[model samples]
Target: MVLISLGPLAGDVHLLNRACKGAGTHEDLLTEILIGRSNEEMFLLKEQYRRTHNKDLVQVVRGELSMKTERMFVMALTGTRDESTFVNHQQVQQDVETLYRAGPGKIGTDEIAICGILLQRSDAHLAAIAQAFPQRHRVSLTHMIESEFSGHMKDALLHVSRGAEQDGQGVYRDTQLLEAAMAGMGTKDERLCYRISRYHWNRPRFGAIKNQYQQLYRRSLRQRVEGETSGKYEKALVGIIEQN
Candidate 1:
């Protein structure tokens, strides 16, 4: 694969189209791109998806997923998440209570209640919620999602929590995704390409992602790439990540 780019936003629309167009949905691709995006970025992605495919990204994603997972994406697609950095501690406490009652407070999880608060809140709000959740419930939001949900919804919610905890720059989330692309076995070239291109358009974020990867894994991203890949491919990945 060439790891082509029309920039991150454009490439995202294309990757999403490809994820949804075929018989099999690339759920991981769909989840990471859809979740954790800023409201403006989400708006542009939906607009671009509509322009490129003449299809609403929401409906397209809804068609691919079912039940709670579908609703999660639908809620995010509204592009209504509060973007303000102001964290109303009162509202954060309220959200924390709602989340606990929705999941741990009751026998069956109230999926909508959980999704609404997480998906619709700002990162500052989410950061407060994350801080308060464990303080109140004694378990992290990540663990709660793992216990209360399954499959794609779980993954998506975990993405939301981790992104929030990282202050919503998504450095940790991107670091995990980037490493996931290169982990376990043969490299996932297409995903690796898409992920690199996604951030390469923003040098600062790309560099932050590399730094975060090193912080988490104790090795530079370039070293890991060299271990897993070779020749021109390795050179390209190393070059992209090693940019000063």
Candidate 2:
């Protein structure tokens, strides 16, 4: 099947206004946008929304959505993938630190968030997260779950974080990535949307990105990032991982 490059179209306002005006619910729109569409299709859809609606599409959907469904759709719409592989690694490390710092009762939100982020990464990165969890926190991630989380949430989190080494390891080459992003003629226009989009959908990496903040600018990558960029593009350049 051809990959969709539409980039979060269904979530935009034209479609969303239709939903908001009682044409269809947000869930219906989300299904159309995220399911069985190529990235190009998603990108085009977002553009269509912007043209038709003066307001940002994501805001429209978020204004209406709630709970888990909201989480899923908003994540789809944010769609920021312009990041370095090493930056991703650094993000993972930062997440681990956040997990370690949080108290037991405070672990749930951050824990699930990290797991969600990690899901977007390759097996290689997943393994690293799992391995590092215990070493950094002085307790196994699994044990943390057993003690803190329960039921399906616990089960799901464990499954996603099981092995990171294979996850983020072999998928993309760092040198080639840097070359493509920086050394090429299109460097100024470069966007690592693939990596961010991958992680946005990827549960594990999404979780990690929430708390991890190690961008090239020496700021939290999360703080530096702004979804659906318009001006200056500082969000794209500041958060990329530096090439060693």
Candidate 3:
């Protein structure tokens, strides 16, 4: 079912397993895994190695790799841990710092690649990422994007960052979401209406991100989309946000 046999992971797995059997140092397996393909599958391999060999996979990974290779493996494996918001936050902080150093102009597919790894994490972790970016970069990640990124990539980053907020549940609730939306709008009745709508949307348990917009917002997230957007343009933007 999985294409593992054909990817960078193939030989890497055998090497890792051999190393886990005490035939090689932890560093050896770490090197192989760092260069391996398939993050999700690699996570499983690390778990398997630990189970079979009684080694801390991440510890080995840290000892063997450095720089971008190290960062990449760490992000991939740490994200796989899933429940540790602490790890997610730490990785995000590091990545945001890395991105800031690279500056807006240097951002590339790797930025999106690492972001893809991060999105697998819970919304709480992702939201913290959004918060961390501005703090670290001394600029809103959104503003940075507005300056350098455009079209789908920009849209994707915004969606990912937006989802970082409270697993994105807050974005749907009319009361909670609208309040967030209208926080600085300086309008009372509109804010009140959004507030009234949110309580009914429920604060948790959106089946998917879009459901939050559809049920909680009382309009598809697209239909309600504002800001330099309207009509089908809003729909397309909302659609992107919903998907990410």
Candidate 4:
């Protein structure tokens, strides 16, 4: 499974356990569970994870992942993301400069520094930073992240970046994730199911994201699913897409 929204702490715990229990972690699933969570949400998740799994979520993460990816999850597990809608332009500029130095301006990528800024900023503040970064560096922050990072770390950072909204629309990231599940030759059934299920919890917003998905790809998300999946799976995925 790829993701879930807040609440139903048990679902989050189940997904986290599934991601971390085996030999190799499920990076995409791990990214979705940990990214975009509020401090309170993360607190509930950590508590639930311990009750359900009898292991500290952070400790399990430390044991499962290594290097920059591990550091990124650890910072996210701190449950300290600034959640205010307030944007600080000065700080955004500073972060932009820091990212520039950490990425394109440096000889080698400073992965942790980049992780710190992405992990700490509020969504509103991060959206501001994303805008300022492109203006200062002549490349979009998403593009820069793609250039400088790879693997799970890159995916997590991209999740953080796109989670920030532009012009008050918050569906872009979700829309992108939905398409990613069905993109390429074969469909990612579990990811597709989890993503649609996650969004289906909020009908109105899910409706908006689905409409945006159609606008972006010039084909209906439902139509895309119809083409990629068949049998009960096709009907089920299409039903959810159509429900939106």
Candidate 5:
């Protein structure tokens, strides 16, 4: 259960305030609070932010962030991309075709179409889309993505399209997140916090994520964090991961 200290909603609002208050935008803090929340939770947080701060959350984020990240947070705050639990089969097929033509069938990947459809739809819808994709196109959505896109865009599309199931691919998703966090010269602290904060409270899901991390990487999530970071930050990350 979510701990009720300041109240989850109030705590989220304060986190956002801190994210926007500093000399530079604390993208990590913003990402941790915003990206991990459900659409309904986010809607309530925005409402509470306005109630407490007398300012719109989206507007506040807009002033502090820019470009793609700004657009993503705005969409997330407005609850535009939250998916409904119920699936529409016809719409799923249409989305599959749209995604196909936007990527594999075209000369160049249609980043707009890809992001708009994949990011906006609910996980259930995406699962349905993934299920139907190969039936019509003779190719998996994952394969199509691998063929058409590269780098972070590819990773995001794959992660979103993987649906809510905790299968092998879901495990792979956790590994990818760990790799992203620890990749390159310096740690991507925002990405690390976002992934941990998003699932740390749910013991079962977080356990599965940790299991996947160990199976795929041959190292525990805590070990990875310990190796990549030092002192308080590393302790904080390991604490979050180990939290039930």
Candidate 6:
């Protein structure tokens, strides 16, 4: 695929439309574009999609995806989520209780409810939620997640929780994402590419991400990729990581 320098919103809509084309959808392409975007960016992309294709972006996504993936995309496009905002202690407490009853406090995990709260709130709000959680419940929110869920769901919830917590100007979430891509046996190349592609153009943000990755893992992200992959693929990954 030739990557042209279209404007951000226009480029995103173009990729999304391409992903939705005949046969089966390019799910990795769709996920990489949608999941990497901010709520405000997604809102603009939806409008741009309508102008470009005469169809709703959410409708297009729904037609192409189902279940959790569909829900994630639709929620992203809704643009109701907060980004960086003052913590609402009262609401945070309520959310904590909601999560408690949904997960550790209950027999079965309420995946929908837990994810609903995680997805809608801003990272700052989620940090507040994580802080307040231990006061209400004996375990930390991360602990509860580690205990209550398993497999991909576990990873997703953890991503939501950890992504909410930012240290200084650095994004700790990128460290977690990098770990996820490298965890277990083989590399999750699609996820790795998504994360690198997501921030490669934003020098400061990507720099912070790289810094946090080193802090968390005791090695450079480029080093880890070098150790895990080879040939042109390795070169490409390292190039993206090193790019300004």
TM-score of 2: 0.34
Give the C-alpha miss distance for residue 242 in model 6, angstroms: 2.8
Q: Report the C-alpha lDDT of model 1 over 18-100, residue by residue, as the tens digit.
A: 88876988988888788867888888999988998898888889899898888889988888889898879999888999999
lDDT of 4 by residue, 186-217 (tens): 88888888778767767898888878988899
Ranking by TM-score: 1, 4, 6, 5, 3, 2
For model 5, how does the per-residue alpha-carbon lDDT over 1-244 read when each residue is reduced to its tens digit? 1222455567668768877996987765675466424678877988999999999888998998766556656665666664578988989889989998998889887876777776677767777877888899998888888888765445545666553333523545665766788989999876676566655656787788788888878889888889988887777778878777
TM-score of each: 0.93, 0.34, 0.36, 0.89, 0.67, 0.73
For TM-score, the strongest prediction is 1
Q: Which stretches of candidate 5 lie over 4 Å from their true place?
A: 1-37, 64-74, 80-86, 102-116, 138-159, 162-175, 188-194, 232-236
State model 6's lDDT.
Answer: 0.74
> Residue 127's C-alpha lDDT in candidate 2?
60
Worst 10 residues of 2 by lDDT: 170-179
lDDT of each: 0.84, 0.47, 0.48, 0.83, 0.72, 0.74
TM-score winner between candidates 1 and 6 = 1
Error of 5 at 27 (Å): 6.2
Candidates in descending lDDT order = 1, 4, 6, 5, 3, 2
Alpha carbon lDDT of residue 186, candidate 4?
A: 81
Candidate 2 runs further than 4 Å off = 1-45, 48-56, 67-76, 87-91, 100-127, 134-244
